[model samples]
Target: MKIAIASGKGGTGKTTLATNLASYLSEEKQIILADLDVEEPNSGLFIRAEKIFQEDRYKMIPGWVENDCTYCGICQEVCNFNAIINLGTHILVYPELCHSCYACSELCPTAALPMQKQKMGVLKHYKKGNIDFVESRLDIGQEQAVPRIAQTLDYINSISDNKEIILLDSPPGTSCPVIEATKDADKVILVTEPTPFGLHDLGLAVETMQKMNKDFTVVLNRFGVGNADVEDYCKKNNIRIIAMIPDSRQVAELYSRGELVYDKVDSFKQSLDSIKHYILGK
Candidate 1:
């Protein structure tokens, strides 16, 4: 099963849940752990595996060829991302704003638009016994992460068979990045805290998932430290909160030290098993 552990906002313990599940599930299952939170991928920091391979990822952006006669704003008009800007005398193309749909280049009346491969991020591969680890890290100052996340998912899916479980650690927010990361996932684990902001963003994320027709549920983090407002919202929406991780200083310290909670506490592993059972409907 391909499962994406995602959150509506940041600091909701997605990396914590994803890394632990990947580590624990590897004991008996052949799994691929994909960290698609390219903007800030800290899951790799917690994976504790040797790096096997790495590659720089690139995306095609619109490049001016300077062969055109007409200064028409057709390119700018056709481009929805505003990557191509027409100043009447000179048309400027911003690579950062480019989504690389090739619409500006394809529909250019003067055919003066070319393509440039902009370095977006890096893709890394690693392995630890039975588990295969992959992560995408977006370069600083880059706005586009959806493409890199898609490539990461595609890479894992291409190599993995049906028996292998793909666990995706997604970026926070209900944007294109999260959707790209979890679009093809068989299931999605929405991680959230019990605070007001958490509940609000979780609702946005659920609506996004529902619109996409994806199977998803909540994994409540910071259970005791905050109110049960999140639980009430879930129950009202008919959303199932399968598991919860309490707000413990011990767990926090262990996380800060880059140690697995299950290795230090027995109950942590049981909690993971409970999550697994819920996913498998056992």
Candidate 2:
């Protein structure tokens, strides 16, 4: 079963749940813990993976062949992102705005546009104990994360078939990168808190998953600190509350030291085991 852990907002303990779940299940199963949050990947901080392989993740961008150019505006016209623009005497390619769609190059009348691969990120594979970790680090200042995420998924496919249970730590929010990460997941675990902000964001995340036709459960982190808005929302929507992790000083201290919560909280394992069983049944 492929399960993705995600949240609509940041600081909702999404990574905490994902990392601990992977750690708990690794003892009895062959699992791949994939950190698909390229912007700020922290899964490696919790579970260290021995570096086995590393490679640069690249995305295609438009390259203008000035030598072969007839300054036709076709390339600029075909580019939907405004990545390619034709000035009076020159054709410009903006690498950052470009999505590497190849439409500009393909529609160039004189074939003056070619595509070049730009390094977008780095994909790294590592193994620690029984679990395999696959992570992607987006290049600094890179705006587009979908291509890098696609590269990460490709690495996941190459390493293991769909047979082994995979746990994905997705990026926060309901964006394209988040969608790409959760696209093929069999079940999604939406982690939230018991606050008004958490309730609002959780609704958005739930709607996104429902639109994608994914089965999901909610985990309320820091359950006692805030009001019952999240729980009420879940009940109204008929969403199951799989786990409620109480707010604790120990969890805060462990998180500050970059430690996994399950290492200190023994009872957390039972909730994760139940979630695992629930996912497997689906």
Candidate closest to the true structure, highest TM-score = 2
Query: 1-282 in candidate 2: lDDT tens per residue?
Result: 789999998999878887888888887788899999999999889887689988988888878899888887888888888888899599989999998888888888878888988888998898887789999999899998888888898789888876788999999999798899999888899999988899999999998999999989998888789898898889988999988887888887898888888866766666677777776674
If scored against the real structure, what TM-score would every candidate get? Answer: 0.92, 0.96
Model 1, range 83-202, lDDT digits (tens) per residue?
788887788988888888899888887788877787889999999988899988989999888889888887887778878888999999998988898888999999999999998999
In model 2, the runs with Cα more than 4 Å from the true position are none
lDDT of model number 2: 0.87
Model 2 CA RMSD to the hidden true structure, in angstroms = 1.3
Error in Å for residue 180 of model 1: 1.6
Range of the 10 consecutive residues with the lowest summed lDDT in candidate 1: 63-72
Alpha carbon lDDT of residue 36, candidate 1?
A: 88
TM-score computed on alpha carbons, candidate 2 = 0.96
